[model samples]
Target: MPTIVHTIRRGWVYSPFTCEYCGHEDQGAIHMKVGASAQVGILQDYDDTRDLAMGTAHGNMEQAGDELIALSPCPACGKRDELAVKSFYAKAKPWIGSGALFLVVGLAGAGYLASEGEPEMGLLATSPLLLIGLVVLIAGLGKRLRKLPPSAVFRSRNPEPWAHLGPERASQ
Candidate 1:
């Protein structure tokens, strides 16, 4: 029986926040790492896990309008409050684990053959797989270049620019 190997990835999302003080923007990211096996009768396990992660990352930004608001100095420029009000969900990238696996297997096979005093056979046996691994790796990288949709901008009813600031700054 071919060991059924499964590659799993956790879901993640992030947004960009610009500092109001110095107009510096930093991307806020949320990632959860999860791994599991895909048994023939339990395929839904992976989906359920991934969906839960996605939901957790996508909070009610609208209701918690001030949740991301901060009064700390801008991380990039040491300023305060000039942060951009708009928040967007970050894009998702495709995983290229297969390419890496292929590369590793191919190289290991070559190394083993070389150590066994079969340099020519090792070169011939590994050359094709190495080339294929490179091709797949490039394709995977290309897929990552495409951008995914971000969540809609969280809107707030508060009109004050500093309304998102915490209560500590409210008295200021």
Candidate 2:
């Protein structure tokens, strides 16, 4: 019997960003420290767990950064600007196109093979393509229906100072 062990590791990610409203850049940048856990196993499941952990940490950092920017107004302008976040349609376009192509090619090939009395072979070869195309198409469409929050928003209830104010401004 194989024994599986789980391990947790802590790490930090440094993200440098510019203020969209005032063009102010952070010299020291923001430090996002997070922890991720992974399972040790003899199979591919270990890799998947590791990947998931890392992705979770990174995603948390990104969300934190976005919220920070949204809540804190530019020190120079005292106002916030819109952040540019990729939309669902933009991210799903490639997958959707690829799925459609796969479906079309698979269907065409299957039809041609049927005319030649090799329909069974054609389906055996193209079945994988059709299945993959259907799965990808459904996934892409599901993503298209997801509603993502706006890239930036002004939070008047509890405003905070910008993370990195320049040296001259810091002293004042």
Candidate 3:
């Protein structure tokens, strides 16, 4: 059996928020891009994670217990609360957009051929490729819409290196 491997570029997005009670500004929500691949892999190993941490840390920072401290106490308020996730989403642009484009182009070419009176040839030429593209597009969109990162994403109470927290937590 041959081992299969591929490269994927992924990331987490965080937005700033303010505490209404104490006029404190901090990261309000963390938006992570999640999908099927995320279910079985680790996100912390990616270089993007290092950059994300650099943006949030202030001083004397270090990785503790294989996890980065993405969230910290508000400078003024001194309260360590979980920030809300603005949205749970995944990047499907590559697959969905490309797949749709392929479908359109293939159909257009087929239509042109049919207009030229070779209807049979047109269908034969474009059907397979169009079908493949359509399947890829749907799969991509489904992964993006359904698989989502969670706000309570923590392992051993540590920030996940890739920030792909985990499954959603039960509401209390």
Candidate 4:
């Protein structure tokens, strides 16, 4: 039987004030810890069962250390395990993983055997260096083999700075 692992994250305002998102009227201050979470302010623990996750509203931490809450379900963003954000590569399609697995194994076997065999005086034929070379070769090939979509081009962090954090314009 397969089981799904649910990851829960939690974060809280250093001290409750205006909503983080709207930033309208300030909400009364409440001293409370958040709960478990993936990142510092990605998601929050919802209920006792620890199934659903709550998104952070908005709140910044203090400097020099004054108003620190937490995420232990116990400090509001004071301190807790960091949030978990999936890596770009990790979210790849299944085919990528399949190709990578095949490449790694193929190269490892060839590499190990080549290294264990014999070394020549003029040019080294097999050694630790060869194994490492094979691993690198396989990795590079696997990266290129992955099925990447045109839209995913924006995945690179280097995408235009403005494209990512551009100012918001009034909606029509």
Candidate 5:
């Protein structure tokens, strides 16, 4: 059986509110609005886990909880789009843009060499910057390709989750 994990704070999302005057109780809804994303570190260790299976399973799942975790805003309530990824990307662009620009220029040089039919070794040796830039450019391009086209994305349907059930707990 797959078990659901509570990754967000549910109580904040669905809070029971009391009227100051009449004392009527109403459940307060938190938009759990889309917010900026947090920086996450890549895991280098797998064996050092309280639950070995959990660690292994988490390592196996690539979509969520690894590079990009769940986008759930809140757990208790229907908080949607809590992780505002686009905004985070936009802010980081100013700094990353220059590097990306440099990478493109390098890739262009590489392309020129390839077009000229330069020997593989000679071509790579000629444009060190371009080689580095091409690597960076390709990585960025790969990420963009994973997302759907701009128009039919959020409107279409919610993105699939990273994982539903993790590894079974080690029987005590």
Candidate 6:
């Protein structure tokens, strides 16, 4: 029986960002690790595992680093800004506007049909659209109203690192 060997790759992404509130510059880092396994005797398979692990580590590091930079507080001020929360609501504004439009149209159409003496038909035709619009509108509003306190921001032990890994310097 061939023994299986596991290979692991580790990587980190570092980003330089300015504090939204205090205008202080800082560096943020996110670390990631990935592993893959292959039979001990298969050299080619081991190489494939290394490739897989490196790729996974790279992708994860990038995504995690972005999130960290966005949500982490400034090391100098120890406070987080509302930029991320504001951006989130800005992105949802279009969806909320569309949902409101759909809801109004559905209601008007249903009312018009009912006035023409086809109440049941009108309700049956517009019910699905009305329901979908209501759901989307509520969800968008809920997200917009969600609050993020200062404590909610990520507080890393070492938000500013002296040295970090860059994309070109990633090790396999």
Top candidate (lDDT): 6
How much does candidate 4 score in TM-score?
A: 0.21
Off by over 4 Å in 2: 1-60, 67-88, 150-157, 160-172
lDDT by residue (51-160, candidate 1, tens digit) is: 55444434443223232334233456654443322121111122366777778999999999999999889989998888887888778777666443232232122224
Candidate 6 colliding pairs: none
Q: Candidate 2's residue-wise lDDT over 57-150, tens digit each?
A: 6777766655444444454565544543344246787788889989999999899999899999899989999999998988888877776533
How much lDDT does each candidate structure score? Answer: 0.50, 0.60, 0.49, 0.33, 0.38, 0.66
Over the full model, what C-alpha lDDT does candidate 3 score relative to the true structure?
0.49
- Per-residue lDDT for 29 in model 5? 28
Task: Give a tens-digit lDDT track for model 6, residues 1-172.
Answer: 7665556667655666677888886556655455655554655566665566566656666765565566666778876657765674676787788789889989998999999999999999999889888988988888778664332222244533333434454221
Per-candidate TM-score against the hidden true structure: 0.33, 0.48, 0.42, 0.21, 0.29, 0.58
The C-alpha RMSD in Å for every predicted model, in order, reads 11.6, 8.1, 12.9, 17.2, 14.3, 7.8
State which candidate, 3 or 6, has the greater TM-score: 6
Q: Which residue window of length 10 is worst by lDDT in model 3?
A: 58-67
lDDT of 5: 0.38
Candidate 3, superposed: residue stretches over 4 Å from native: 1-90, 153-172
Q: Model 6, poorest ten-residue lDDT window?
A: 148-157
Better of 3 and 4 by TM-score: 3
Runs of candidate 6 with Cα error greater than 4 angstroms are 1-12, 31-64, 146-172
1 against 5, candidate with superior TM-score = 1
Which regions of candidate 4 fall more than 4 Å away from where they truly are? 1-126, 150-172
Q: Pick the candidate with the highest TM-score.
A: 6
Best of the two (3, 6) by lDDT: 6
Ten consecutive residues with minimal summed lDDT in candidate 2? 151-160
Query: What C-alpha lDDT, on a 0 to 100 scale, does residue 130 get in candidate 2?
Result: 94
